[model samples]
Target: MTLDLYRADLGGRTREWLALHPDERRRRSVQACATKDVEALWSLTEAHLSLYGGSGLLASPHTFSAYRTGIRQFSQYAETQALNLLRLTPDDAQAYVLALLAQGRKIATVRGKVASASALYKALRWAGATDTAPFVGVRVPKDHEHPLTKNPPYSAAVLRRVLGVVEERLLSACGRERERLLRARTLLLLLAHTGLRIQEALDLTWEEVHLDEDEPFLTVRSGKGRKSREVYLSDRLVMALRLDRTLPRRRSHTAGMVLPFRTRAAAAKLLKPLFERVDEQGRVRSDWRGCHAFRKQTGTRLYEALHDFAAVAEVLGHADINTTRAYVRVGGRRAGKVMRDW
Candidate 1:
């Protein structure tokens, strides 16, 4: 086996694992290299994983993890088909697409996998590891262009309903549970009013908030791509945040964050009950669920009020105005409003 050909290219953790399991590594490498096609596929995937881990393509850890999973899943699928990376064809790529569809994967998930796999192949071509780019310009299935395009934004009344329910629950709870409800309520308000992503809110620290300022805003230092932006808070949101700051602590907070959770999972656990209640009571007007829907709602409201895509993009901290457009989903509403007013 030519394990030495790519041994140095392994990511830090992969290399460490290989070092710890010398016999297993030897066995796998031998198995991978026993056949010409087998060695080529294994080497290409390892190289892809190595490049992906080091590329810093996606900034958020959650996003990076998803891309990694997608790539691994595609590689496994390719292996099952006895595909060779060096001699891949567009037909092979289409077969994989069909296979994903046959497996009943969601359109979004299938698209993500295809994108990740295509990107990996692009990287391999750029590195001069592959002779041809098979997945280049491959099209995913129809009606699966983008996830946000399919999901309509939640209504303002639904946002108010979510907040009202949380407030009502807070009034009846006590002790640690009360604090949990309070945190959930504050998060819901912030998401609805501020247009901040849930992760940005979860990672927000007390020090990042400037409630005493003339115009209160949060300093999002750990935003996507580690980019920093000032997200202004509404008057009511500022007041709620201020009161939350002064409230007595129950569970210990980590990273000095405003919320008790240092991770998304913990925050999900805290907010699940409220979301379930929302689902049970049919407060949501659309199929779009989760905290991110609040971001879309805020973006829609801002676009409606400001009528400036650039300004809305700036508020949402979107690197691309097109992404902001997707979030806002303005479509013909603005034109209709102008026509009616004129």
Candidate 2:
């Protein structure tokens, strides 16, 4: 993958993959021991990851990591059964599903694990690394899990409290400190209003940010599925973006990149204080915390205001509308309205 499509999940594998001669990689796959088979498949997975990463078809780093975790777990299963990669059968796939279910993982979580395994097999088959796609047409149970129930959105009051501190800091600080604080505030506001994923925002370049336009918006390039979308700027968020642009240069970088923060961890490091403050003040609810709450909040508000699932889905950069639906909370107001006849 080129720089724009590269994901942190693949890490150093990209270099490793590039180092291998193309003909050697394909030739080596023909004579595979269990270890060699797995290695070859993994190398091919990395290659596809680059393609998918470029198109934004891949999920977050955590999701990519989950795929690797599933592969590792499957490898363990293979070893215990004395089965090579090609020897994996439909029965083995069933056993894996049963084992995951037996572990009492939530149905949704188990589904993800199974899906990851399935993806590995599918990729292997496509790359000619394996003879068969073992998990093909395997029956996986549907999960009734609600998205809103998982990472429950923060209440308006809590979100306000969390963002309010950043706003205050931006307005009050001076010199380089003010610039630092401004960047943090801008990042928070972008997450809050836009519903862009953490990676997509960090991947932004100056060319994508339109501050002076009649309708200000951020051109989100690295959205999921590689689908680029425009996140319309809110009046307040527009102000934040403008202020952030005005700040003194903090780090040297190539042209077009928006934030000086290089990685997801860097961005998270800058927001740790805000998250901690929310934790200290008891503003964060049972399970909700950090930047994701802003995304959920954005989803909830936009869905409620526009009353259009597709609109919200588009804004959130979800390839599937159902994915966007999960981020929206079914608040009491909507429930109450439905029960209004009573």
Candidate 3:
């Protein structure tokens, strides 16, 4: 089983899986754990998670996945220099920032890398990975907040095609696969209209969706730090959502958000499996694809249709208007135009 894929949800599961290996005994020594500075590395990572009060990030797959990947990159960078987190001097952190600058990276880009490293230190301290903080002198400034600006909202036509693909699969698929496809289709369709994040969509429960009255809407009880919001559901969504609500759920007893394929990491494992199942039973390259792509896809579509930054921001639920504004800043003006293409 891909227990490691669920480390954020169930932390000890990965450790349990790793303990099963025959070589685990040899690898468990404290010296080996810290050899080449891995201990120091883990220490910093724990600290980062703690400082942010990462319950939001942990529950939100998009941010959590990015944190894991970003921290891994930072760890590798430190490895190249044979530096340990416990002994991570301010000079080392400063030099890393300078390296990004030398490479002609923008200040925003450089800040992300540094902030990631600092976050590691926070998580590490919380986890008791380190007895003391590694970065005492280096102060982590408030994170640079900006909106997603490059990807325009999806146009009516592109939204049609994306939903069209999902609708096609729902009819053609069979059994559990068919059911799963239907759920995914429903999710994509809802996002195209409502501007809900994928995580928010996944968190839906039957009780939360109200359609008995003339007006229909879903109550998002908690999202990204337990904030609640009410989104009026489109008539089409209110009707279509009933399909999955009737099916037997794996965990929930009633109608709910139907993305029941698996954990967020399910796609990472399924990319190859799905292709193999229908093809010549051969392996396909598992590109870094996930559900987040669909979220971005729909968001861009909405941006195009509305053409108003505030409208896009409201749909996206960006705490700061600037964060929603970032969709335009993504690649460039040319890229923004391209996103508007059907």
Each prediction's RMSD to truth: 6.2, 5.4, 9.0
Residue 243, candidate 3: alpha-carbon lDDT? 73
Angstrom error of the Cα, residue 240, model 2: value is 1.4
Tell me, by TM-score, which candidate is best.
2
Give the least accurate 10-residue stretch of model 1, judged by summed lDDT. 33-42
Sort by lDDT, top down from the best: 2, 1, 3
Q: Write the per-residue lDDT of candidate 1 for residues 1-342, one digit (tens) a residue.
A: 554423442454344433535455444433442343433433444544544544443355565556567766776776777777557799998888889999998777788888777766664554444557777777776763554666666787766666777878777899877777777778777888888887888778889999889888888876676778998888878877877787775566364668866676776666556654435667753333767777888888998899898998888889899888788766677688899988
Ranking by TM-score: 2, 1, 3
Which lDDT tens digits does candidate 2 get at residues 1-342? 554534354555554545557655545554443464555555566556655544333556655666677677766767777776666788888888888888887777777777767776655554465677778777767876676676677677766876777777767788777777878878878888888888788878888999899999988877666677888999998998887777666467734577887677788778776755435767853323666777888999998899998999888888889888788866677889989988
Clashes of each: 0, 6, 37
The lDDT, on a scale of 0 to 1, for candidate 3 is 0.57
Instruction: Write candidate 3's Cα lDDT for 84-116 as tens digits.
Output: 755677788777776667877766666666666
* Predicted model with the maximum lDDT: 2
lDDT for residue 300 in candidate 2, whole number 0-100:
93
Residue 330 CA displacement from its true place in model 1, Å: 4.3
Candidate 1 clashing pairs, residues 3+ apart or interchain? none
